[model samples]
Target: MHLVVRPLSTVKSSLFYSTSSHVPARAMVYAQYGKPSEVLSRMPLYRIHKHTLPDVKPQDVHIRFLAAPINPADCNQVEGVYPIKPPFNTSLGSDEPVAVGGNEGVAEVIALGDQVKGFSVGDKVVMAQAGRGTWRSHAALPASEVQLLPGFNSQVSLVHAATLTAHPHINVDNVEHHIGDYVIQNGANSAVGQFVIQIAHAWGLKTINVVRDRPNLDELKEYLTSLGATHILTEEELSKRETRSKLKGWLDGRKLRLALNCVGGKNATELGRYLDHEGKHVTYGAMSKQPMAVPAAPLIFKDVSYHGFWVSRWTDTHSRQEREAMFGDLINLIKEGKLREPVWEKVSWKLNASEQENETAFKEAVNKGITGFGKGKQIVFFED
Candidate 1:
C-alpha cells in the first residue's frame, strides 16, 4: 500500500493558510522542576507562524509528528528530575519557559537536508534522542538521530515507535538464545516490559515475568500470556517456596542468563536470586525510586553481574546504523504480530475542549502505577 507523503512546508501551509484562523498548537511546557502540578501546566501552544522552517543543517531531517507518548522519563524531565534536558530555544517565540515536553513518538519524514542519504519523504521514523520537543507538531532533528520504522500497521504504529525510545541498546538480533531459554523481567506489565516479553517470545525465548498483584490478577496474566509470555508471577508468587520449587523444575535445572529489572528495590533483589551463574542483569529504570541492593551471595557465589542501562546514553554512544537496525528488527516483529503494543488508555490532544480532560487523565495515569488509579499507560492522541 502506498503511503501518504507530504513535505513539512506543505503541512505548515495547509495548517496556516489563513493567518486569521490560525491557532497555536498545544504542548506540555515547563521551566522549573517540582511537583507534576507545578511543572506541567497547560500553556498556549506554538506553531510555525511564517514560511521559515527551522534552518535544516546538512545533517538534519524535518519530521511531522504522527504521535508522541508521555513516558515516566518525560514526566520526570518536566519535574527537572532527569539529567538530559532539551536546549531552550527562545526563537520559537515563547517567552515563558521556552521548553517543550515529550520523549517517544513516531514521525513521518517531511524534509531532508542536502547531505542526507537513505531516507525519503514518506518514511515512518522514530527519534533516537529521548527527551526533546517531540510533544510539539514538528521536529527538525539531526539525520543520524532518526530511526526509520519498517512498514507497520497504522493501528500499532504509534505504540511500536513510542515504546522503543526507552531501550535503544537492546538489539533482538544480538541476543543469542533459542526457544525455552529463560528471559526474566520485573515490572512485566509496564510498557517496556510488555515489549520485552513480545520481542523475547518472537526470538523464541521463554519469559518469566514479575508483577505486583493488582485487583485483576487473572486478567493481567491473561493479557501477558496473550502477548506470548510463558510465565507470569506476582511478587507474592515469587516469594512462595512452592512457586520457587515449581520455577526450578520449569527451567529443568538450567539457570536464567538474562534478567531485566525496572523496579530497583527488593523486587530487583528478588529477580537477582533467580539468575544463573555468570548471568547478566540489566537495570534500565528505578520505578520504585529506591536504590538497588543485591545480596552478596549472588555476586560472590553466582558471579552474577549487574549493569545499568539508560537507552539515551546507549544511543549517544552507538552509530545511527546500529540504532536503525535494532528498530527494524522490532518493526518486523510487530508486522509479524509477534510483538504487540501494551494496553493503553487514550487521551485526546485537543487543547480547547480536551485540555483539562487530558491533564486529569494524565495525572491519573501517572498516579496509577503508585497509587492504583488505573492500569496501563495513558496515550495522548493528536488528530489533524
Candidate 2:
C-alpha cells in the first residue's frame, strides 16, 4: 500500500483546490473522536480535509465513489461509539493521524492493476465490510476490498446499489424463518425493518411490523402494508393485552418464531412478549438508546433465545465467495422486483464545487439523518 503525504503548504490553506497531476482527492476526515458535527471537518475550518492519493499499484484498483449513505451506524462510528473503528492513519495527508468517514457506498472502478485479473475498469463494486472509508471522491484499494454488483449493470440503480450493504445482510443473517413461520419486528419503517418485511414476504414468511404512532398513522400503516407487511401496529397497540389476543387470532395457532428489534427499552421487551416457546429475538440496532428490559418469564419458561446481529462482523467472518454470493442473491431479488430501494434524499458532491460547499452539504445530510427530519434515508451522490 502506498502512503499519502501532504505538503506543509497545503495544510496552511483552509480550502484546498488541487491542481496537481500527481495526486488529487478529498474526504471528510477527523483526527480526534467527538460529536460528529464538532469533530468532522470539511476544510481546515471545520473537519473536512483534502489529501493526495497514491498511484494505483500492481495490486490496486482505483475507484471513484459514486454514492454513500449517512447511516446511523456511520454517525455512531464518527462519534467514537460504534464497535468497528476505521484504522486511524496519516493516509489522507493530515498532519495528525486521522481516518475518513463513511462505511457503506458503491464505487466505480476507473483504473485497474496489472495483477488484478477478476475486476475490470468499469465494474461497480461495494466495500467487502465496514471501516473502509467510502465518504470521499476517490480511492485506490486492493481488489479484495470490494465485490462486484452483479445487478448494477442491469436493473439495480445507483441508489439501490449504494444503499444495499447493511440492511439486507443483517436480515438474511439474523432471521432464520421457514416459509410458514411468522416474524415480528419493531422499527418497521426503518431501512432494515422494511427489508425484513419484503425479504420475509419474498420467502413466504409472515411479518407483523411495529412502529410508533404518528399523525399520519393510517397512512404509514398503509404504506408498510404495501411493502408486504402482514400487519402494522403502533407501540401502544403491541403492548395491549387485547392486542396479544388479536395477534393470536392473526397467527391462527402458528408460532411467532422470530422477533427483530431495532428499538430497545420497553418497546423491545414488549416485542418479545408474543414470541412462542423456543422463539428467537434478534436485536440489530438501538435507535431508542435504551436498554432492552426483557422479562425473565419468556427466557426461563418459553426458552427464548436472544442474539445481536452486526453486519460488519458478519462480513468479516464470511469468505469473499460467500459475500459475493449474497450480493448476487440480493441483485436477483432486485431484478425480480421483489426487493425495492429505500426512500432517500440525495447529498450530491460536485467535483467542481469548492471544498467548503461540499463539506456543508454533507454536514446537513448528517444532521438530517441524526435528527430524523425526513421520511427517507440520506445518501451522498458524487458527480463530476
Stretches off by above 4 angstroms in model 1 are 1-26, 41-59, 152-156, 169-175, 351-375
Q: What TM-score goes with each of the models?
A: 0.82, 0.90
lDDT of each prediction vs. the true structure? 0.68, 0.80
Tens-digit lDDT string for candidate 1 (222-257): 988988899999988887778778888889965578
RMSD of candidates 1 onward, in order? 5.5, 7.2
| lDDT of model 1, residue 362 | 50
What TM-score should be assigned to candidate 2?
A: 0.90
Model number with the top lDDT: 2
Residue-level error in angstroms, candidate 2, position 367: 0.8
The candidate that wins on TM-score is: 2
- The residue ranges of model 2 lying beyond 4 angstroms of the native Cα positions read 1-23, 40-46, 169-171, 174-176
